[model samples]
Target: MLEPGLYEQTISRELKDELESEKDELVSELRKIDDAEAPKILAEYVAEVAESALARISESGKDSLENQIQLTNKMIGALDSPSDLVGDSHQLLYLVPKVMHQIRGKSERDTLRPETPMSQSSLFTGSRHEPSMGSELKKEIASADRIDMLVSFIKWPGLRIILPELREFSERGGKLRVITTSYIGATDVKAIDELSELPNAEVKVSYDTRGTRLHAKAYVFYRKTGFTTAYVGSSNLSNPAITSGLEWNVKVAQRELPDTMAKIRATFESYWESNDFEPYDKSQHDRFVEAVKRERGDKTPSDLVYFF
Candidate 1:
C-alpha cells in the first residue's frame, strides 16, 4: 500500500479517512467478488466509476474538485500494491479510467475555454501530431552516428550518381533496404538497378505492365537516437519533376519509426508475394478499388482507373 507520503497533505488526510470508513464495506464487497463467477463485471464497475469520476474532474477542475485527482491517483497507487485485482487487465480497468479523468480535468482547468484566447499551452496540446521540418533536423542528421533509409523513390537526378554513396555504405559496412514502384520505367528504373547491384543492399521493384498507376511516395531515415520520415504528395524521383515543379512533403520525426517500418515491410512483402500472379488476381486491392468506384462517383481516383 502507498504511504501517506505518496500524497499531498490535504489529499492524504482525506483519502486515509475515506479508506478507514469504507474498510468494512470494501471487505464485504471483495468477499462477494470472490464468490462471483463474473469477476470481469466487478472490474468493469470499478473502471466505470473511475471513468465517471475522471470525466467529472475533467469537466470541472482540480481546484473545483478540491484536488480529487491527487487523491484518486494515491488511492489507485495504494490499490495497486496488494489487491485481488493486481493483474494488469483488472488493475488497468480500475485505475486507467480515473487517471484519464484526472488528466482531462487538469487539462480543462489549466487550459483556456473555447471562449478564451488561445496561447502557448493551447497550441502545444491542440494537435496530437504535427510536421517537424527545418534546419534543426538537417543539423541533427549531419552529426548523427548512423543513417538507414527505405524509400519508394528518390527525387535526385541521376540516382545512379548516388550509387557511390550506396557503395560507400557497403564499403564501410552498413545496412539499407529500399523498394520502389512507379507508373513508368524512367522514374525508378535507374535507382532500383543501382541499389540492387550494391554488395549488401536489398531492393525490390514493381512494374504495372497493364498501365496500372503507382502513386504513393514515402521515405524513412534513421540516425542515432532520432530519425525522420517523409510522406509526400508528389513522386519526384526524376530530375525533371523536382527541378521543374512545386512538390510538397510532410516530414515527421522518426521516434515512431519502428511501427512505421513494420507497416512498410509488410506492404512490400505483400506486393512481392502477389507480383508473380496475373494482375487480375481479384485480391483485396481489387475489391477496394471496385468498392471505391461504386460508392464514390466517377470523379474518385479509383473510378478513373481500370484494373481488370
Candidate 2:
C-alpha cells in the first residue's frame, strides 16, 4: 500500500543502521583483545572486506574475486612475514639474472660461427685488427682454473710480459704446468727459475735436445665454467711471437670441438707423465745450464755463461 519510493528509502536506512551496529560491535571486540592480538583480528576483517568487495565487482564482470582474494592474501602474508618475503625476493633477484645469462649464453653458443674475429675458433694472425696472443693469453689466464703451456723454448722477455698475470693466477690457487726444452738454447734459465718459484707452478724440461725434438707450441686454458680453449699453431711463448711477430695460431674451443680438446688433454697428460720431460729441480740448475750451453755449442765456462 505504501509508495514505492518511500519503501525503498526505509529499507535503505535500516540496512545502513545495521551496518553501523556491526561496525561498533567489531570495534568493541577489538578493544577487548590484547594490543598484539588486535592487529591480527583487524587484518582478518580487512581481508574479508576486500574479498567481499571483489566478489561484488566480479558479479559485474570486472575481475575474478577468487584471484583478487588470493592476491590480497599473498600481499598480506608478505607483510606478516617480512623477513621471509625479503629472503624470497633476494633469491629471485639472484636466480632470475643467472637464468637469463645462462639462456643468453646457450643461444650465443648455438648460433656461433667459426673463423670470425669474435668467434672462439677464429684464426689469430696477429694482425692489427685481431687480438694479440699476449693479450688473449692474459685474458685466459685470468679466468682459468688450470693452465698448460707447451713450447719448444720460453724466452725471458715473453715470460716477463705475462709474469704478472701468471703470478696473480697462481696466487688464486690456479695450477700451472709448463713443458719446454733446451732444444735450441733459446729457453732462458732465469725464466724457468722464475716459473718454478711460482706458488703453484710446475715446469718440465727435456734436456735431450736432439732426441726429444719437442717442437710443439700450444697453450691450453682449462676453465671450470666449461669454456676451455687451446691455441695451437706456430706461436711460441716468445715476446715477438706473442706480441709483434707474424704468428699464426688457431684457437680451438672445447665446446665447438670436444674430440680435439680431448686429444689435446690426453696428449698433454701423456707427455706430463713421460720420462723424457723431467720436473725442473732448483738444485740441478747447474746441470740445466750445462745442457743449454752444450746445445748452443758454446765452450764458455759455466760461471761465465750469461742467460739472455
Candidate 3:
C-alpha cells in the first residue's frame, strides 16, 4: 500500500502508443489544412491533450500542473514551427515525435511521485542530510550565494580558515550578514572587525554582557539555483565549531525541510533590528577589544574559553 498522501501510477505502454498514433493523425490533419493558423491550432491541441491527461494533477500551487502543461506546449510549438510552418511537410512531420515525447515526459513528471522516493526519515536520531557537521557545513557554505549567520560568539582564527573562499565569495557579490554577541569574552574583536571590512557584508553584535541568553547558533546559506540550506545546532562561529568538535548541528534544505530556512531568516532579521544589537563598526570594535583586553588582564574565566 502507498504511504499517506503519496501515490504513484505508471502510464501503460499501450496508452503511450495510442497517444503517439493520435499525435501522428493530428500532424496529418495540420498538413491537410494548409492554413497559416494550423500551427496555433496544434499548440491548442497539445495543451488540450495535456490538460485532459493530467486533469487531476497539482503541484506547488493550485494551477502549477496546468501552468507547466501550457508552458511545455507553447515551448514545443515555438521550437517546432517558428515561422510559416503550414504546408511544410518536413516541419509538420518533425513535430510528431517531439510532441509525443514531450507530452509523455510531462505526464510522467507531473505525477508528483518520486523517481526513487523516500517516504520518511529516521525521526528518533540523526538528520535530513547524512554524515556529520564540519564537512556538510563547508559544502553548503561553498554552494550558497548569501550567508546569514547567528551565533553568540565569533573568533577571527575560525573565520581565517575560510577567509580565502569567503573573499572569493565577496568578490563575486555574495552577501554576508552576521549577528553575534559580546556577552562572554568568547567573541573576538578581530573577527568582527575583519568581517565588517568585507564587501557586501554587515556584522552586528549584542553588548548584553551579563546573562545575554542569546545562544542560538545557525548558518543559513541561500543558493542561486536550488533550495536554501541552514545548519542549526550547538556549533558556534569558532575554530572547533566549524572544523572539529562534538557539535550537534544538522543540515536542512528549504523545500524538504519544515520552514527552517524561513524561520532562520526571520529570526536573524528580528535580532538584526532589535536595540540590543549594534552594527559592528570601528568604535564598537575598539570598545569590544579594550573590554576583552581588561577581561583577559585579571584572569580568563573558563566560560570565556571556547566550549562545545
TM-score, model 2 to reference: 0.60
Q: TM-scores across all candidates? A: 0.37, 0.60, 0.55
Candidate 3, 165-191: lDDT as tens digits? 677667779998888876646778888
Off by over 4 Å in 3: 1-132, 293-303, 306-308
Q: Which ten-residue region of model 2 has the weakest summed lDDT? A: 86-95
Over the stretch 1-308, how does candidate 1's per-residue lDDT look in tens digits?
Answer: 33332321222356567767777555321123344544555555666667787677767754734455455666578677544322332211112356656766655433212221111111111122421222212322232333333343443353543455457655555555555543322333334545556666665444443454445654444444333343333434444332333445444444434455557546645654665222212233343244334433435434422210
Q: What is the lDDT of residue 165 in candidate 2?
A: 86
Candidate 2 regions with alpha-carbon error over 4 angstroms: 1-119, 298-308
The window of 10 residues in a row where model 3 has the poorest summed lDDT is 115-124
Q: Candidate 1's C-alpha lDDT?
A: 0.42
Best by lDDT: 2
lDDT of 2 by residue, 37-142 (tens): 6675565566666667767757766556455555655775867864443222121111235765676675443322222322247688889897788888877776
RMSD of 3: 17.0
Q: List the residue pairs that clash in candidate 3.
A: none
Model 1 regions lying over 4 Å from their true place: 1-162, 188-190, 223-232, 240-244, 256-262, 272-308
Clash pairs, candidate 2, are none
- lDDT (C-alpha, whole model) for all candidates: 0.42, 0.75, 0.63
